[model samples]
Target: MPDLITPTTRLYRAWLDAHAEWGPGTHEDGFGLTSTDDVGSRAGFASWVRRLGDESARTTCRWIIEDRQVLGGIALRHHLDEYVRWAGHVGFGVRPSARGRGLAGWALGRMLDHARLLGIEQLLLVCAADNMASATTIQRQGGVLEGIRDTPLGPARRYWITLTPPIG
Candidate 1:
């Protein structure tokens, strides 16, 4: 694990390159990593990541890197608020160019490994009802559909991943 997550990390820079600088009429970038200037510099990101999972802290985020390159990222949120209740525990994104290669599923499995370490028993993952890709990824990670809920963001489906103990 990284001692700290920073914008200076190759993963952060690669993520910024993957989804930064949106044009008109485009969908809002989902990763929320677009803030890369002085107003949202690497230093600030370091600070933000340092506080994740503190007492009652909402979330903890991490990048998926292999062979010194960032393939994607995953976040495990502790609980829900009015803003996040529908979304549940896990959220993730892979680079657009890296899609369709099963990286998201692999990355999610890796996230599950860490989630178990975090004492997460029943992990909830949510994606937009229309996001079949994410839904499939979650399903492959042993997710079972719990229900769907309407939210300010839209309709979202939540799946639960029950963490099982490793074979001794």
Candidate 2:
């Protein structure tokens, strides 16, 4: 089973391996990595991890780990902002090697539980319109389509998932 963990410098090597597999881009959606984050050096990685820790009030970022290997990442934003409006309240990505094992669905379910704890009654998620796998994953979790919108990244499907309170 894969577990979600807070980003830490101790997993630097593992994280780098995953990052490299994504092959040079700022599009690793769930990791909260920006173009400016320098994660290439030890000090830089430590600082990056600290920054993620500092952003706890506004967001929750978790790494998907299995057997001590970084498999992917998932993030949930606590509140809406301009970026969140475009990117959605939640985002996730699984490494290429980890794609077919249902990890995204698992991570998303976990994040929805976290959202409920934070009092967020619903969440918005967007994915490239052609991403059938992601659309299917969200649909499996009760996501309702809200139509596709053309954005800087091209047409993207928007979905909303309402959270039902846990049973006693």
Candidate 3:
């Protein structure tokens, strides 16, 4: 798997910028939509690393796909029961130069593996009702559509994926 996942670091600045400029589309936007310009700075990126390292409360992780020479990332923001109900265990994005290569789907599958390790039984993945690609991705991961909700962005569809007992 080429260690397809890792912590976000200063070394990833170039990768981050590439994906950042790609911006948002589909029924969703970029993966790090909540991040500020400061968060994209070196110092700010360091702070983000520290927060993700907490491993308690809400844990976050950013993983890059190494096999493909593509700017892609997956982010898991834990404690979804609080700030997010429509969102799920993770959100991810693949740069415009890398779309249609199955990188998002691959990254999402890896995120689910990590979620299972964290003892998450079910994951809620939310996408814009018009995001066929995202909905297809979630469904490919065994997700079942729960319903839809009106949000500031637009109407979002919620899908739930149940992890098996083994969870491996």
Candidate 4:
């Protein structure tokens, strides 16, 4: 199993390549990366990395890696942001070339274990309604769909993974 680690600028090039393979406009907020250059790719991403431990921000970003190859990004947001309550406790993306290999399902299952240890009783996740691949990944990890909900980004599928079982 690949370990989720603190972003190291050393892996920036490999990370860039992996994401680039995912194609343009695939950037997500939790990605913690931007176009690579001598400019601010290192500086900006380094700044983002510095905030991973900020409890008040309620967000954490980590890269999934094994054998020094960057596979993808996975993040866990401890609490819902103001825009959408059911948005997600987690968000993840795998390299386009790395898709369809169960990478997402594996990453999610790892994040769920992390969430449970943190006492996150009910974890929510949302995916664009048109993203069939993501929907499949979520279901594979035991996400129970709660129907689709409207958002600023248009309709999104909402799912909740119960972290702690009900009182027995």
Which one is best on lDDT? 2
Q: In terms of TM-score, which candidate is strongest?
A: 2
Better of 1 and 3 by TM-score: 3
Model 3 Cα lDDT, one tens digit per residue, 1-168: 423545556455655556556753222233343434345567866765566566435655555555544356666766667546856667776667667877778778877887877777888888889989888988998989999998777899999889875523
| Candidate 1 lDDT over residue span 24-109, tens digit each | 22232223333332224676545544443242245666666555555566666765565455657777877666679887787678
For each candidate in turn, give its C-alpha RMSD to the true structure in angstroms. 4.6, 1.0, 3.4, 3.5
| TM-scores vs. true structure, each candidate | 0.72, 0.96, 0.79, 0.82
Cα lDDT over the full model 1: 0.63
Residue-wise C-alpha lDDT for candidate 4, range 1-168, written one tens digit per residue: 677876667786787677667666546434644454221367855555555545425666777787788888888888766633855778888877767878778888878887776677887888999999989988888889999988877899998778763343
Q: How many Å off is the CA of 85 in candidate 1?
A: 2.7
- Residues 1-168 of candidate 2: C-alpha lDDT, one tens digit per residue: 889999988899999999999988668879998888888889988988999999999999999999889999999999878887778999999999989999999999999999988889888999999999999989988899999998789999999999987655
Which stretches of candidate 4 lie above 4 Å from their native place? Answer: 24-26, 29-40, 53-57, 84-86, 165-168
- Cα lDDT, all candidates: 0.63, 0.91, 0.66, 0.73
Candidate 4 is scored at a TM of: 0.82
Q: Over all chains combined, what TM-score does candidate 3 have?
A: 0.79
Candidate 3: list runs displaced more than 4 Å: 1-3, 23-37, 55-57, 67-70
TM-score for model 2? 0.96
Check candidate 2 and list the clashing pairs: none
Stretches off by above 4 angstroms in model 2 are: none
What range of 10 consecutive residues in model 2 has the weakest lDDT sum?
Answer: 159-168
Q: Give model 3's clash tally.
A: 1
Candidate 3 local lDDT, residue 84: 62
Candidate 1 has which clashing residue pairs, if any?
Answer: none
